[model samples]
Target: MQPHNRRTFLALGLLTLTAACTGSHRHDPDGGDQRPDPDQPVRLRAVAATDTLLAAYDALLAAPGAQTALLQPLRAETARHRAALTAGTPSTPSTPPPTTTSPTTPPTPTTPAALAVLERQTAQSRLADLGAAGPPLARLLASVAAANALHAAALGAPAEPPAPAATPTPTGTTPGTSAPALQKALSAEHAAVYGYGVVGAHLPEDQQRTDARTAYAAHQSQRDAWQRLLTTLGATPTPAAGGYRLPFPVTDPAGAVKLAAHLETGLTTVYADLVADLPAPHRPAAATALRDCALRAHRWGAPDTPFPGIPDPTDPSPTPTTPTTPTT
Candidate 1:
């Protein structure tokens, strides 16, 4: 199978599970007390929100002297978010239906930084919408939220201060079930910690080296956290491999930047899986981590993807899907 196709399946695997679990209940009037699918309203609100964002993009792009070079990529990402959110729904047409913005609507901010504030607001709303969704919709909403966060960074918005860490809940664990996914996440964190060491070594600029060092330290902290979480669940965490092979040779500063992007992009995918597989209480952490990965990946020159961790079918040169191999 093609690599991107496999990545797509990994990303959407939970949706298939969600469908099988819910499909039998759809037409059961005989059961007498039918409740509506809880995800429907949340999905609708998300779709509406994306439409508003697209309108803002259209307004910003149409304005005189707009910075198309920067704004256009962000806008393109927003469009892709819209497509992902509405993917399997009945109302989605093969061709996008025409859309028009009302004259009464206020114009979007002319400055890119100001526009980024709106992007951040959209991201917050997506997170807010997460509470009511089932696993399938929740995963998509998490990706959308993270993608908007990346868009905000792309537009030069100041980073919001990190939220205080919530105590990890043990609700998602079932003897052997959550262990494998948690272990997968831990394993990826292990790679990131090692990869950043290489990144720090090869990067030439002082500021870039400092950034690499900071990323390395952050991964260490996350790696340790995952270890503790696994222990708390009575599972052994996977130990870091002695060494990891770089997907591509990191022989220069340019290569270091690409390697950093590659590492974070891979972590983003692992966390996205945790968001889907773990319980609701655990999802916010996964979502936040996913956003952090997306932001760091973009900072290191990765092309902006609408669904940050998930491979974009539209991308000709998608990131590799397999975990980096360990070298003895």
Candidate 2:
């Protein structure tokens, strides 16, 4: 295994051990006090990590020739992350506010590459914590980690090499359990495969067509995997609709690119839910899929969000409309 993969595996094992040790407890009878929440430390650590990254962005933006156009969107995304992490966890006697570093007077030598490294490290750290977190927080951490991974790539950094997927263990369980989430993901992949065909047709550029083909192939593969998993689980995978109604018209290349972004953004949300639903050992694949979709969405000009799969409560925009399924 690669050094990073080994490190991640060790970290996850450690976190799992920690969770098992501390996750379940009752009121302290000796002092008649409540036990501390086990997830708090993990949450606080994540908040601190995000704050540090946000400060780095501040320092870099303060420096000369910082490429505001490129960095600004990323920075904004970090702020959204901050908001999400800090929402219910307020500063108190026990939990202090996350410390933020003021930009230095001269500001340290900060570059996009350095920031990308930070993003990658932060992402790994969050991934490590996944095993220790509660279902909701674990889902959030996975989403943020995925976002940071994409952020690293957007900064021109080498992509984080893919981790090996865990071997599937089909229990022959029914749809009332985790199989439903997998089925949902399969449905999204189906729509994505269909949408990419439309996108490829409208994209005039060779590179765009190539990207479309790659995305199409990827979705098809994912769809097949979901089907296999469902079959093993004794659940029937839903058949793809004859056609999906597009949310908007796609008559030109610009429109095609928009559709592509839309496809990925929708998939990210589906996979994020899968992250929360799957068993700990299996969650990594769903998280990776979420990250992949988020990166594709970013490249296709989708607006960045701190939480890729989950909707940000801070945004007041109306709920996004999903593609309607028409009868065959």
Q: For residues 1-328, what per-residue lDDT tens digits would candidate 1 score against the true structure?
A: 0111111101112111111111213334465654555566776778777777777777788999978898788787777777666654544443344565578433566677777887888888887766577766777788889888888887888876444333366764434577787787777776776677677768765888877876777777777777887898989899765444556676898988888887777777777767777666677777877788778777788777777656552345635434233434
- For model 2 the TM-score comes to 0.74
Task: Show the lowest summed lDDT stretch of 10 residues, model 2.
Answer: 9-18
**Candidate 2 overall lDDT versus native:** 0.70
What does the lDDT read for residue 209 in candidate 1?
85
Candidate with maximal TM-score: 1
Best by lDDT: 2
- Writing each residue's lDDT as its tens digit, candidate 2 over 246-298 gives 66787899998998888888777777777777766567678878788888788
Instruction: Score residue 61 of candidate 2 by CA lDDT.
Output: 94
